[model samples]
Target chain A: MFLQKKFKEYYSRAEIGMPRRFTRREYGFMFFERQMMLRHISFSSSQKLRNFLTEKAPAHVFYSSAYYSKPYEKEMKDKEWLGADLIFDLDADHLALPENCTYERMLGIVKNETKKLLDDFLIRDFGFDDLEVVFSGSRGYHIHIYDREVLELGSRERREIVDYVTGNGVSIELMLGKDNYAVPSVSEPGWYGRIGRAIGSYTDRILSMDDEERKKELKNVKGVGDVRAERIYEGLKRLKKEPRAVNALPKEFIEHLKDRVAIESSRGEADEPVTSDIHRLIRLPTSLHGKTGFLVKPLTLEEFDDFDPLQDAVVFGDEKVSVNVLKPFSIRIKDFSCNAEEGIVEMPEYAAVFACARGFCAEE
Target chain B: MQPTILAKYPFLPEAFDLVKDESMDEILHSPAFNRARELGVARVQRALKNEDSFLFIDERNCFDVVLSFFISKAIVSQMNDSFLLRRHAIFEAKNAYHYLEEESRETADAVARSLGIKRDRNGVSFVTFLKYSPNAYGQWKLANSRLSGGMVEVDDHTFLRLVQEAVRERVEGIKFSVDGLEKTLDLGPIRAELANRKVTHRADRVELESFPPCMKSIMAQIENSINVPHQGRFSLVAFLNGIGMKEEDIMKIMAPIPDFDDRMTRYQVEHITGKEYSTPSCDTMRTYSLCFEPDGLCARIKHPMQYYEYRLHVSSKKV
Candidate 1:
């Protein structure tokens, strides 16, 4: 009887204030719609009263006046802990009431105004065909999407969708009407279309092909030599288009192509191998079997000059010999038939021992 | 008149009483008084006759003479107490040693200066103490304060000689001698000598006997093991035949074998074989086999049965 009376009063108010285009049932409580309507009641009401209203006329409650109450204030402290689907706290201060109103009256007015604003915003901007609001037991109301698919989306992607709805910088136009904001179409070429859209199209094309065809095209494509680049291209293409009928290629071949493509692309135009004239001299240990340990004997200046009468040589310590005190006399002994082309140097064991000893002693 | 009578008459009761009271002289008979006066005059006459009469009158006993002698003669013996005797002697000895030490330091410094060797303060003291502090003998002379005759002293030379003997004995306890050995022989030269000696023994059958039987057997095993692979690959039967042992006999000698997996190549087998045998599987097999089981024949052989069993076990366990 009380619910019938309340409905009659709300109905009379709706008839006078709401547009006549809405159906009588739309303005009144349908069986499922009651849950959403009763949720707007002020929290100061007794639990018995709330239960009674909710049991018969279950309405979506929006708790928008948490600023005035200490309990509600404490509950909304950790915005993250609320697990709210959509938090509307950014511009909550604009919903505050005048000082003359009592707490319950102020809350009621704010709740009604906020609910109307939310309904209008959702319908006009986002075109949400179905939405339900619930009191957050704190500052803002939670807007839940009962659709499972929307909930199944990854957290990051869901955040992106939420950002788009909230009119973030890149997606602001999505929330505005055609008169207020215009989104550029992909059909006309712009900076985004040329670079971003073109890459996306190219990726779609590559991913649409079979593995064998893809490999052939990859192999034929010039400058696609490095593996990482090829893998990235393949990934972008796969993301853009559906899989083709071709079987999965062997991992080794795919990896090989990817590596090659990465290397080629990274190298760019400079493809030739580097060349140098400087040669490295590797000093090998003297060994008996190689004839590298017994051929050239280290001799003093006097001995060297006497042996080779054509040139005068002077010994400098143990390792060096100078001819005429200026130009040094150089000799390289070859091992195994004395072949200079082989770069084999033979040194007498006794001369090596003497040289090593003399080198160490001279350093000290 | 008599020496005994004179000694007793000095301490007599009647004389003591007469001295105590002037009226007591009337009690003394005239004869007694005359006798006493004569004795007294005689004593005075004796004193006037001798120039050394005071010395005789003040003569001391042996104990008093000894005490005075010790007090006057000894350097640090001022008190007669036996407890202080050792401490006084020690103090006097320390003082003497310190004086000698300082004097020696000065002398050493002068000598070093003359020789043109730099002498710092510490260096001078080090040399002085090094010389005067008993040398390495660990003995030194100390004064004896208890003696009454003269200043205490010790024979330092005799003490030093005894210390030297003790030290010599200790040194001799662990002495070693190498007779007829050249001190200048280099280890390198010894190695060269050994190499030359080894070459000489190569042809000597008697020298071969110097190697123990176990060493000879190991050498033979190593030689045979290496030679078998070089000769050619032998079948199970052929290998047994070459070794003059049947399969069962060979297995009996080397049984209760552990299984290996197929992944374990012949190189692994050869590795456990200590390079005594080589397998065609891989170059590292001999080395691997040597690491696990160097002594076993199975380490050298790649048993197909064991490999299969190991593989089966591994696959089952994995499953």
Candidate 2:
């Protein structure tokens, strides 16, 4: 139920429009996994439990999972040795913990003990909006703030960010010190508007749903808020209907619409009978056989090239046949070119039909 | 023996024959010979004036050939088989003048102190020369263990002045003073007897089987003061100064063979202390010593052979 609520919330907030469909199975799985991952209350679950986070409070999180396993062992030995809470197929060479503790009672004793550092130092210096948190699902949380504006930043810049946040010359243990979580202020340009735009776009999707969908989705999606669902629904609706109006749309949207139309049309025609074109006639090449010529009904290019009408039929008098009163058909008297060059001759079925329906061809 | 002719004039044997008709004494005292001596002296004086531009003085050819024979032999004798000096030439008579001047100053102060002479002026002249000279090729060879020709030259007077200043500073700046101190200190006769008497029964015992009482107390103090354990049971010398007893003395007393010859093992040190002594590995010791020397005193014991080699190697190749 929690997963279903989460999925509905996600659906309401998501910006996909134009009758984009989801299988019931996929929706159910996503909801179930998210709920199970966030079941435990710890600093690492901050991302999972972000809906319950209070405004402006700082929190530290760590991401951890068991890295390896053997058939004999239920869990990895190193994971157990390190007291890891979850196991995953990822490297766990280094263990990290966050400096600040937020929402002490729910997170755990470790977080409660580390809360003062978050409140006194990090919160005091770095404003509440400067802090962002993500759940790592297993042992830790990833904390990020979209506030750096370095252009074309590379891997080195990421390391520089780590160094700046941790403070120069500060050891990992010192950065995660129980007494202090506040890092010194690093003078750097702030984050670009591009990052804010991305966040704004996602937030809009989550908040676009109408009231009925929003309420239903919110109940299912644990973290989805009403505002996000409304935004998402509105965005989706705008995306779906706006291009059909007089206004021009982006090429991508046009393509998306075309694909949607094709899918719908194909579904509508599923029960129709299959038929070949009657007006179109395909020509084929000649075929031959030893001591006799045999005419073959051509099906494809290869058969058409192999069939030789002149060689397959013996030369004889020409005749005319009529298929209907308005249409007449002509044929030449011919003998069978196969079977020891026997003189047995036959005309095509079209000629016979023409003779029955109308008069014969006129002599010329 | 016939009067020895110092100027054989080997390159011009005929010149010597033409000049040899006169008595040896007459030639030796002749104005011509005196003129030659004056020419030699002038040549040396001119070189000394331009010594700053020369790498060496050919004392053998320049001084010995025409200058007074007595001065050349004196300079040559002082230089014996010291290979570094053998490769360089000296201004024998000129250097003798300087050496005598230095000796006179030393004698003057000694006489003044002994006889209580209150002369206002000591009349001692300090001669200074400005010159550039190369170190001998052999000196370079000794330093690098390879033959090389490039040598550093310095103004001898300036070098001596720097040396004097450095010595004065070092002597003045040293914190510990051994002045007026007696050479010997009394130790209990029991310890002396233990050191002198040959104890044959303990020959098979390990060198660090036990520590002296004084060393044991010092080890305990070190252990308590620093959280780290002592490296090993040590001698009284190590306990006092954090260095082992001098190797030469150990060899003289104990006559330890191939195994214990002045180099004590970690196990042996631990055996003596009756305590677990955990010494950092040699590499760790080196790293810690380099990092923490200015901040903290390193408490690692070094092998005497290693210490001696370091000192010898550094001194021989000192920049």
Best by TM-score: 2
**Per-candidate TM-score against the hidden true structure:** 0.14, 0.15
Report the C-alpha lDDT of model 1 over B123-166, residue by residue, as the tens digit: 22111222222211112111000001111112333323222222
TM-score of 1: 0.14
Candidate 1 C-alpha lDDT tens digits along A23-123: 11011122322333322222333343334333543222122211122222222222111111222221124444677654335435545544443443333
Clashes (backbone N, CA, C under 3 Å), per candidate, total 40, 45
How would the docking of model 1 be graded?
Answer: incorrect
- How many pairs of residues collide in model 2? 45
Q: Lowest summed-lDDT stretch of 10 residues in model 1 chain B?
A: B141-150
- The lDDT values for all models are 0.27, 0.26
